[model samples]
Target: MKHLNSQSFLEDSLKRKVIFLTGKGGVGKTAVAWATALTLSRNKRKVRLISWSPFESFSEPTTLKSLGITWHQLEAAACFKEYALKTLKFEKFFDAVFENRVLKAFIEVAPGLSETVIAGKVWDLFDRGEQDTLVVDLPATGHALSFFKSPMGIEKMFATGFVHRQAGNICDMFVDPYTRVDIVTLPEEMPLVESGQFVEHLMGLGKFHLGFLWLNQCTPDLKVPDKIPSTLDKSIRECLEDHRFRLEREAKNLVEAKKMPLVVKKIPKFSSEAVKETIEQIAAHMEEK
Candidate 1:
């Protein structure tokens, strides 16, 4: 069931050219990100789905190969090299200067460099107008905070160079009207708490358009029957009991989510495994007008 302020659920999410999905680890952000991308593609929106986290099963290439969406994984080393090439303005110049093994290793270990590279990459692609939409599955809450902070650091350090300019451009994407930072969460304790904390943190930073708080894997509410049919098998009864317990838990969590300052949109739980079809089901929900 949808929660408070759920109107325009898909519209508010899709209005942004770049939507960043983030939440606590294991909160199913990647699933929602892929599903949202799939919906965009099916609707004839040119979309690119990017993931910064480690390899996830949802990003399996074969599943998305026929979906008409461009899938990209942004690694620190590669993105940094791409940034270097753009700055140096020549492949030969980049190969000669940044070819050193020491610098390459540093790229992997540099603090917040991954975050910077990611923002820079997206900025370049958006500026180039390569696609109509970019759906990014960002790292968990803490890492995402670093991403929001990285560009300002780059601007301060370089002060006056290609890096500084690019950093400003990256920063621009954060406060831009078409950029969104959406949170995905399960109907549980820690995920809900962290979602609140993440928003509190955002308040102290640059103006970022807060989109929907995607309540992932919610169980559909069912009316409590006055009596259970004793004719059912024992194991089936046990499964029904479990379902009731989950519904109770989800109802309480939904109440908690509404208290937050963000609009809560829900995605009903589907298969036990997050397979290709699960994504397709979610895509359909996201396509709802």
Candidate 2:
């Protein structure tokens, strides 16, 4: 992959209409998303961070309190309420149509419909001109695709009139150029492979405009032989040589930068607070345009 600094790639991505951060679980997508939101807010842009995890609350004020940003949890109850109001606003007729006992019973029983309603609410957020930047802390790999592809799936699964129209409208939000996808990964083998698959899947969706390949927890290069060879037995020398070779393998790949996807490489590891710091670094690079 092309050598990337988070600062530059992030700065460039911010120019797009919508910016999405996604990846397999435990890859730090949420932290990076929060950091992006915080950095954009500090740049004086109106921002909102939305989390879709039902079990975990996104109420950590300390995460962005210093940066003057708020994280909103998209719990089921709140989503249902927001969905009801937004639907009522979209078509005044729905105010009464959705009130029927039969329809209410359907929504109550088929919770999947409730998920569709939440998707509609997300589409509305983009339409309402509420904020300059909207950061979505999406579900992990297994469900993130469903969240983005739900409208299309609903349209196909239920080939009716009203529902089809609604799905079409929701799909429109995703197809717009303002939206894009970013997948986070580690340098290790499995995550890297999964990240590649995520990128390929997003490309298949055709709705994601900007694709970001973020390699997190990267070990900083100890290039140029920074450490002198140790005075040790032959076996230790062989081990050190192996370590040095592994570190420089990718650096050698940089020779053909244009052919590879740009990567935002972060630190190997850090504490929770480091999340913000890493994001800040990314946002700073994103601003370099």
Please name the candidate that would achieve the greatest TM-score relative to the true structure.
1
Q: What is the C-alpha lDDT of each candidate?
A: 0.79, 0.63
Please state the error at residue 64 of candidate 2 in Å: 2.1
144-256 per-residue lDDT for model 2 (tens digits): 77677667678777878555678887787776766766666666667766766665676578645545565665555555455646777788778667767766654443332
Colliding residue pairs in candidate 1:
none
lDDT of 1 by residue, 1-289 (tens): 3222345756665566898889998877877888889887787778999888632334577777866668988877778787777777767544756668898777767766777888888888888878888998888898888888888677776668776777888888887888877899999988999998898788577777787888998887666565667898999788788888898888898999987766788888886584677888888877774
lDDT: worst 10-residue window of model 2:
251-260
Error of 1 at 9 (Å): 2.8
What is candidate 2's TM-score against the reference?
Answer: 0.75
